[model samples]
Every structure is written in structure tokens, then in C-alpha cells.
Target chain A: ELKVEQNPLFLSMQEGKNYTIYCNYSTTSDRLYWYRQDPGKSLESLFVLLSNGAVKQEGRLMASLDTKARLSTLHITAAVHDLSATYFCAVSPALYSGGGADGLTFGKGTHLIIQP
Target chain B: DAGVTQSPTHLIKTRGQQVTLRCSPISGHKSVSWYQQVLGQGPQFIFQYYEKEERGRGNFPDRFSARQFPNYSSELNVNALLLGDSALYLCAAGRPQETQYFGPGTRLLVL
Candidate 1:
């Protein structure tokens, strides 16, 4: 079974500060995804890292993947109050087909609180 | 294009009762997936359907079942519900090898 672990389950940061959330998976996977979810709302895709060393950035948030280490990271730069939400990292273990029917295994999520 | 849509935003049922949830995929999307999210936890995969056929299923009990229609719409049915079954049920749509887009989810409360 694939297992995903995330660090700093709860984070509190002041506006303008920077922080990083770490996600580590136990099995081999080809794709890693980042998503943000607010209370009572659906998940919003942040980034999709498809390869090792692949990195994607949107606004003040950036995500990177390292397949060899089975790890991924989400970095926040100059955090804002609006960025307060739960962020999740998911991994899909479709090494061969690249598009299998297997669903993603998700981390517990990092609850970020950006104080203004 | 509109994102994935689900019907009956919220539902309440008792133990041993059955509930059916509906989902409509995006216009050109042929794959539909279902997930369950409990409070303070990430979503867990339930089923995946492509071309109106079951392609994948998660580690759920036999009481949980799903089916897809020709139009790419889908329904999730749960029988003999337990209190643990109360959660937010989410539906997602996408094409093969593409990112899945999720719906707002239906909140089900089992008493």
C-alpha cells in the first residue's frame, strides 16, 4: 500500500513570512498534485508535478517534486491572509501506463493559518 | 465549461437506510470518480468509471456501489449505511491522462 505523510499538520504564520510544507510518499509514483481546500468548499488544483525535478509556481506558492526520494514540497512566499487554507499533496502510482485507473493517495493535509 | 456537478447538496439518513448520490461530468469528460472526505481528513477514492464501465474501485465494503451512464453521468449508492458513512461525498470528472476536476461535494449525515 502507498502511504503519504505530511509535516507540520498545523502551521501559523504572519503575513509576509515564508514557509514550506513537506510531503513524503512510501511508494513509487510518477505524478504528484497539490490542492487547496477551504472549509465547506471543493478542492482547487495548485500544481501537478509530473517528473522528477519538476517545479511549478502560482502566485506566491510553488511546488516541486523529487521522484527518487519519493518526496514533494510546497513553498509559500510572502504569505497572505487569503492564503489560509488546508493544502494537500496527492500521488498517483501509475509508473507504466501513465494513465491508469488507480486513484491518488493523499496526505493528511497541512492547515495553514496566515495572520495579517 | 462548467465543472463537475452533483445533486442534493446535503442529505440525512438513518442507519440501515440507502442513499443515492448523482454526478454529471464535464461536457467532454468521459471519466467520473467518486471520493469520500471526513471532517479533518483528506478525500478517499471510492470508485472510478470510464465509458460507463467500472475501471477501478477502492477498499470499500460491498455495501458501496456505483455506475456510470452513457452521457458520462454517474451515481453512487450506499446500502446499510453506518454512522461512519457520514461524510462529504465528492465527484470528479476528467479524460484519460488529464487532471480530474472535482465538484463541490454532497454532505451526507447518517444518524
Candidate 2:
């Protein structure tokens, strides 16, 4: 089974600070995704890292993938209050035929609280 | 185009009862996936359908079943619901090799 582990389950940082959320997977996968979820809302796609050394950035958030090491990282810069939300990293295992039928294994999510 | 949509934003049912959740994928989307998210936990995959056919299933019990329609809409039926079944049921829609977008989710509470 593929397992995904994320560090800093609960983070409390002040606005303008910088932090990084690390996601480590137990299996090799080329597809890694980052999502943000509010208290009761649906997940918002943040980044989709498809290949090794692939990195994507949106606003103050940046995500990178290292498929060879089975690891991915989501880095936050100049954190803001509106950026506070639970962030998750998900991985899709092998046998990916681009059918979009494969399910994703997700980490426990990092609950972020950005204090203004 | 509108994103994935789910019906009955919230539902409350007693144990042993059955409940059905509905999802309408984005226009022209042929793949739909279901997930369950418990409070304070990440979402878990439940099922995936493509072209109105079952493409994948998670480690759920037989009581959990789902099917897709010709219009690409999908329904998730859970039988003999348990308190553990109380969670946020989410639907995702996407195309081949595309990023799946999630719906608002149906919050099901089993008493």
C-alpha cells in the first residue's frame, strides 16, 4: 500500500512569516497534488506536480516534487491570514494510464493557523 | 462551465438506515470520483467511475456501492449505515490525465 506522511500536523505562524510543509510518500509515483481545504468547504487544487524536480508556484505558495526520493514539499512564503487552512498532499500510485480513474492516497493534512 | 456538484448539502440518518448521495460532473467530463472525509482527517477515496463504468474502488465494505449514468451523473448508496459512516462525502470530476476538481460535498451524519 502507498502511504503519505506530512509533517507539522498543526502549525501556528504569524503573518509575514515563512514556513514549509513536507510530504513524504512510501512508494514511487509521478503524480503528486496539493490541495487546500477550509473548515467545511471543498478542496481547492493548489498544485499538481507530475515529474521529478517539477515545481509549481501560485502566489505565496510553491510546491515541488522529487519522485526519485518519493517526497514532495509545499513551501509558503510571507504567510497571510487568508492563507490559513488545512493543506493536504496526495499521491497516485503506479498503473496510471492517464484515465483519471486512479484514486489518490492523501496525508493527514497540515492544519495551518496564520495569526495576523 | 460549472464544477462538480453534489445534492443534499447535509443529511441526517439513524443507524441501519440507507442513504443515497448524488453527484453531477462538470459538463463534458466523463470521470467521476467519490471520497469520504471525516472530521479532523483527510479525505479517503471511495470509488471512481469513467464512461459510466466502474473504474476503481477503495477498501470499502460491500454495503457501499455506486454507479454512473449515461449523462455522467453518479450516485453513491450506503446501506446499513453506521456512526462511523458520518463524514463529508465529496465528488470530483475530471478528464483523462487532468486535475480533478472537488465539489462542495454532502455532509452525512449517521446517528
How many clashing residue pairs appear in each of the predictions shown? 0, 0
DockQ each:
0.72, 0.75
Model 2's TM-score against the true structure = 0.97
Where does the lowest 10-residue lDDT sum fall in candidate 1 chain B?
B92-101
Task: Please identify model 1 stretches exceeding 4 Å from their true place.
Answer: A97-99
Chain B TM-score, all predictions listed: 0.98, 0.98
Question: Model 2: runs farther than 4 Å from truth?
Answer: A96-100
Tens-place lDDT per residue, model 2, A1-116, is 78999998999999999999999999777789999999889999999888999999999999999988888999999999999999999988765544345688889999999999
Q: What lDDT score is found at residue A84 in candidate 2?
A: 94
lDDT tens digits, residues B59-103, model 2?
899999999999999999999999999999999998855688899
CAPRI band for model 2: medium
Error of 2 at A98 (Å): 11
Q: Mind giving the per-residue lDDT tens digits that candidate 1 earns over A20-108?
A: 99999998888888999998999988888988999999999999999999999999999999999999998887758544784877899
Q: Root-mean-square deviation of each candidate, in angstroms?
A: 1.3, 1.5
Q: Write the per-residue lDDT of candidate 1 for residues B48-110, one digit (tens) a residue.
A: 999998988888999999999989999999999999999999998887656878898999999
